[model samples]
Target chain A: MQIEAISKANSPEIACVVLCCRIFIKTASAEELEQFVQAHEMDWDEVYKYAAFHRVRPILYKVLDNCKIPAPVLGRFRNYCRALSVFAFERQVESARIQQVLGQQGIVVRMYKGLDFTKLVYGGDIGMREFTDMDMMIDSRQLPELAKVMTAEGYECSQIEYLRRFPEHYVANKKDICFYKRSPMGKLFGFEFHHRPGNFLMDQSIGFRELLGQDYLHHSAPFSQEQYYRLMLLNHGASDYFPNLRSLVDMALLSQKGIGSVPEQLRRVERLSQELSMRLLDGPAAATPADNVVMRCATRITKLQLTVTLRSVWERRYMHIRFSASFSDTFRMAMKFLHYLMLPNELDINGVQLFSFKLYYLAKMVRCVNFPGRFKKVFSRV
Target chain B: MTQHDIVHRNEKQFMISNLGNEIVLMDIQQGHYINVNPVGSVIWNKLAVPIMVKDLIHSLVEEYGVSTAQCEDDTLKFLQKLQQHHMLNVQ
Candidate 1:
């Protein structure tokens, strides 16, 4: 029903676009959309929003047809379009500072996610979503040294504990490491260090070492401007651990440009889809006794939907509970919990798996209920 | 488990932060100080609006496996903290 009736529609391309729109609509308003379109040098029309909102399936299909966007790069295009507004204000300043840093350090750091993804994945002439933070990923090994250098240059590390305790663990085992600094403007900006080439979905073996060892693509010093641009989007999109459609769109846009290995990258991510799809359809065994009912009922939604739905549910379930200083801060924590829950599990893992997931979920629910503030006394003593 | 009597008179919004594990009152003006301790932050983030103190205590009891008596005591203490901080305004 969501599919458009275009005769030559690229199934993957169209689906990704539709997905991006859904996410974009959730956080953005009609006025914002217009402003974003104008900032991007695109024609801003009220009708476009209606088409995007009402019959997004067909409208996206038509846009793809007219643009002749490649099936693999649809994700990247959406990100580009969404970032237009913010880019106008921050692009030059941010990129110049990053470029200056890279040049001075003799290191090549690529921009990813927002506008960079648009340039790499989409048509290189798109807008992007209005997200507050900047995500950049550097070589995993270079992170510690880079962090030190940056600290010397006035970038104070926000997560001192993570830097102290998790650098080796993340470099040697886990995914990217998240580090941030409060900008002079008080905005929180993030940087991620990546040892691996692919994200969580891809086999960890495809790390920077392996990819460089195999000499997959041209790996040169002082990378070309195009390479720098594409690398940023690739890194940004990959680090989005959640099945956020906007992230997918960012990557898809890159694929269209024939930049990076979009097809191979997406194929690897398909594993996430296949695993979740199977779990939802076949009714994978419950991890906990209480979770059985929840899982069975949850199967009604697709496995991909599970992550986003659970995330939204968790947010609504715990909106009033103060986890930190602000609702925004608390929501961020809830999203983290949701991300943790999205971890893939082995099929034969038994009820222990179900139990843990449900346990966490229920625990979160319990926190929402405010049970006579029983835990407060214990908390006070500590 | 100690029952912390949480009163939400004139309550508007609430939030829980992860850094210090504190429950913050979002409704209060410039000097909003509905704060909690680490353990309190864990429970504070879970309090949905329109939540009852009893149901909250019951859920905590099941999840943490705490005794009913502890739940009652804890709840009361937490509520007192909220009142002290001017987080909860009695009708």
Candidate 2:
């Protein structure tokens, strides 16, 4: 009659890992707790890594508190949670301070994504989730003034490094770019100044320009709660090959009454895979993926699974109808997508610009050969 | 409505979280925070369950070895501040 034990045995290591984490912070008896640990074989470290990586260490703390886990691990997790909570509070205070200044200047700032999503999903407990950056949407014309304001506050555009390296990056991408400032404590805070720009990977961005004249500036967030959750479900798998587990967890929690989160993620991935398969028929277009291996894997699977049949006919109609764009637009996006891979961006040496196509391709080659460096830099930064 | 009325009232309107040494009381509807110091932190922990002002003061005085008069005075002041911040309500 042990549901936990049954679930653990029936599910895979990954599913059980997510399942235990999904239920760990919630009410659980000793038997449930035993199965939670027993289900995790060579997965404790992996779960911890994902928890920390996704900034859900605070969530992990609550789960581990009821266990007979080692003291050192528990203590470190507690400390991490405490530090994260403090940092989140400071950032919230900072946001309030900035909001005041911007308000006085009559600049309507629409906060969204990162922390806004956290507040809606986790109820403003900063420790409950981790947000390394903030997302604020302003009117497109307000960019210069925001740049001035951030610069006055000793903050530089976070995209400055990327833009410097790839001069066309500004034109190639959407959104107003992000501003950066290092706190006195050495934490880098990024404020993404998004205006939507109608250039998301799926090209289904909310009408940024249309909402400009409205008073959504005073809105709680960029999108309503329903829209926010839906966007997370949609965007998580659109151009990205893999769905983020934590985002999936958030979606699940947000829509618990609906489809279960992990199953929802698998469905989204399946949907997006179809979209990518359509793009493969057209060109090597869409958002950037890491390497040729990913590109080949996706293309090979879709090619075999696809035929000039009823299902393929429906998929072709579905994808094209979903995205309204011309062939030229697709061609431009294809080049831009490749350029994103080739250019010296966050994934490359900072301040290094390779403007020419040849130089860009060379950098791309080097990046593929030195893939471990990418993971190293990310871990180091975190 | 007044400091006397808030003295023993329980918190029901606001949501709260304990971050180890500190506690954060939030008014989700208004998006405001009532932050407190370590001494005020103890008061927050005590307020988790209902207790009279006199009882809270007595416990604090015993735990900190302070005089009853001083404990009562400080507790009243903290309670008054909580009332001003709209964190307290009628039990």
* TM-score of each model, paired residue for residue: 0.39, 0.59
| Quality of model 2 by C-alpha lDDT | 0.55
lDDT per residue for candidate 1 within A46-155, as digits (tens), equals: 22342333223222432433343344434343433323332323443455476577658866565444444433333332232334445454666676667666666565
Residue A42, model 2: lDDT of 38
For model 1 chain A, where is the 10-residue window of minimal lDDT? A344-353
Q: Tell me the lDDT of model 2 at A117.
A: 77
True lDDT of residue B82, candidate 2? 82
lDDT, residue A216, model 2: 56
Query: Which DockQ value does candidate 1 get?
Result: 0.01
Instruction: Tell me each candidate's i-RMS in Å.
Output: 16.2, 4.4
In terms of docking quality, model 1 is incorrect
Top candidate, metric DockQ: 2
- Which candidate achieves the best lDDT against the true structure? 2
Write model 2 residue lDDT over A119-216, tens digit each, in one string.
76776565677667777777665665666677787887655555444444443454567777887668877777765534433454334433233565
In every candidate, how many clashes are there?
71, 0
